[model samples]
Target: MGFKLESREASMNGVALIDDEGRWTLLHTTGERPQASPQIVASNSPSRDGAFVPEVRQPLGAVDMVLRFHVSARGGAASDDPRYVRDVNLAELTRVMRLGRISTMGLVIGGVPCVQRCVVSTSSSGEELSENIVPAAFLVKLLDGFWSAPLGEDRVAGFLRAAEGGSGPVSPVWRIEGPCQGFRAVTVDGVVCEWAGRVDVGQAAIVSGWQSWTVPASLDEWWVHPSAVSTVNVSDSSPVLPDFSGSYAVDVFVDGVKQTLATTKVSAYCGQTFI
Candidate 1:
């Protein structure tokens, strides 16, 4: 069996786990014990005296079983405080877990079941190789019935940059302008968002016209016109690729106000790959 490598970038996000039977489960060490369901968790609020209550959690099972997890970096906005482990929708979490691959794993911040110890990140050089791996267990050990969760793990609130889609003979490139319509931002606005992905041009004709794609709460923008190819980066394929060409439109919102942005039509050709 191949050993999984983790990216060691410090992120205030929760880890996602996939079972050996193709089941997707999210592991939240938010409190002193593991939560059986994600719905029962409570949203955070200000403490009466103005102090934040930091919560830690216990592991659900044996750590030595080689628990696998995915880490995320961006959530609401880039936050220095570590209490807001990012939250994600049940469907999205399930989708990633079902794939059962190391790359599908991502950290979630400001997200549900705020994880307190594991931080997933890519190497500074941004190499896709496994040398850039680090698991949360390495940083914090499992305690008798509980793990000594990181104190500041909850203070994580920021953006979630999706990894680039890669595969086959084509290496695609992607750029996020902003949001449009009722959609969310493709890339985090106002803050600098870091993404690990490439724009892919597919061998097949994927887009006949422009299509609107919703930005998961992770990025800073709202919605933008995504050719079918842009959706590939988020697909089951190792690296998602875009396989069409067209003009894109995006809408922007600030202080609840709306705006529209457009991109000149460009060739969405799936280009040649690296050696």
Candidate 2:
């Protein structure tokens, strides 16, 4: 069969999943779920003040896609094929499918534009015509779970939830230049997180990933998630979706911290992994 669709699109390594070439047509895509579980158990030492439910963050497991397309043998696209040139296009699709994650894979999805790093796990294709066309599909594991907008700082709404999470702003991925005693970041969505560690001029601090953060050139240079000290939970009252961005400038208060978005996108999509 054929899919009559528009307004939604996806790509891998810059190849459009849906295009006018008639080589491939995206039918349906599922598995954009961000599997974020909290770190409460990671450091679950409730000192009474720690009694709050820790933010649960996990990772998006995998995504499965269904597609249909047509091809011709003499078109120089693929091997000999009939049924209105179905297998020919299937062969053309093999290149995109074979593109492994290691070779700088680029995944951009969403109606508004979100990017992620992903690798195909498994896929299948053939000339089993469902209606004068080939039916096929693939499964991929998004390495970073949540998708971050590729460029443009002002569009990220601080968190990456799902494709239908509405039109949010770009992720405020940033870095803090030193000379500032303490740094505090409040996302466009207002999920606040802070760090008491001081940064000397020349050193910079940032939330590297969902795992741990660092302050380069600092003596202790020791690391912490910071969300552990004072942070928000999976179901923090202020928001609906989980803040997998872990862009931790949380709902906690630390005296004398700099609140700035100048460094945003400075680190280029630092720790904006969202749910």
Candidate 3:
């Protein structure tokens, strides 16, 4: 059978249950008609906050999710205390077929978990400003079947070797920060940076699978390809090399960004003296 996933909003204040195959069964507690407790709560598309409520898709057995709610302490009470407490015992409930395996589950407010019954005591008697102190909800997410690959020691050595002896205008700069995983490409300005093979291709996979990236050094005038090597004109009037007394300079590009490395000019000097 195909994997099933679904999410249902807890109605009023009740527990929403789901099975391994992703089916909904709501347990409602009527105020007066407790004997006629319905096995399946009425399906109503309640709007949550500003979003329409719908069944959420989830991976089975994942623990990255939780149930959510909105709740707070009611005002005008002698003490800061919640209007009512919603009881939930998942570990026990699941053992008794009351709850299903899901990634995460929690009652949360303002992105934080709301535990047990939110209570307002004498310590917060005059602090509340609202009549209805409904606390925010808990959300549950399941986390299972997640997989990741690890990097190898050889991969590090391979990358280091490549950086130490790479040929090009760009040099391998010692890593200062990172080359995170899932990064498919990198650009300096608008130009894509090409990977120079110093490390074995196997090592490259290690970096990719492990989420590490390499740092590169700047390159000066150097041979790129037979048709595209950078060059400097020594006899040109504009003096390519500014600062000191260097005669000529070559421009370099890394990942399409211009490099600041300087290259010495190779030109013949000529001057005529008058007697």
Top candidate when judged by TM-score against the true structure? 2
lDDT of 1 by residue, 215-255 (tens): 33243212233433343323211122222321112222222
2 or 3, which is superior by TM-score? Answer: 2
Instruction: Provide backbone clash counts, one per model.
Output: 58, 26, 65
Candidate maximizing lDDT = 2
Residue-pair clashes, model 3: 65
Error of 1 at 63 (Å): 21
Alpha-carbon TM-score of each model against the true structure = 0.15, 0.53, 0.18
Q: Is candidate 1 or candidate 2 better by TM-score?
A: 2
Cα lDDT, all candidates: 0.24, 0.43, 0.22
Order of the predicted models by TM-score, top scorer first? 2, 3, 1
Q: How well is each residue in 13-59 modelled by candidate 3, as lDDT tens digits? A: 23334323222222222011101111232454554334332232222
For model 1, the stretches where C-alpha displacement exceeds 4 angstroms are 1-104, 112-136, 139-263, 267-275
lDDT (0-100) at residue 246 of candidate 2?
28
Tens digits of per-residue lDDT, candidate 2, 210-250, equal 22233553423223324332222111222223333322322
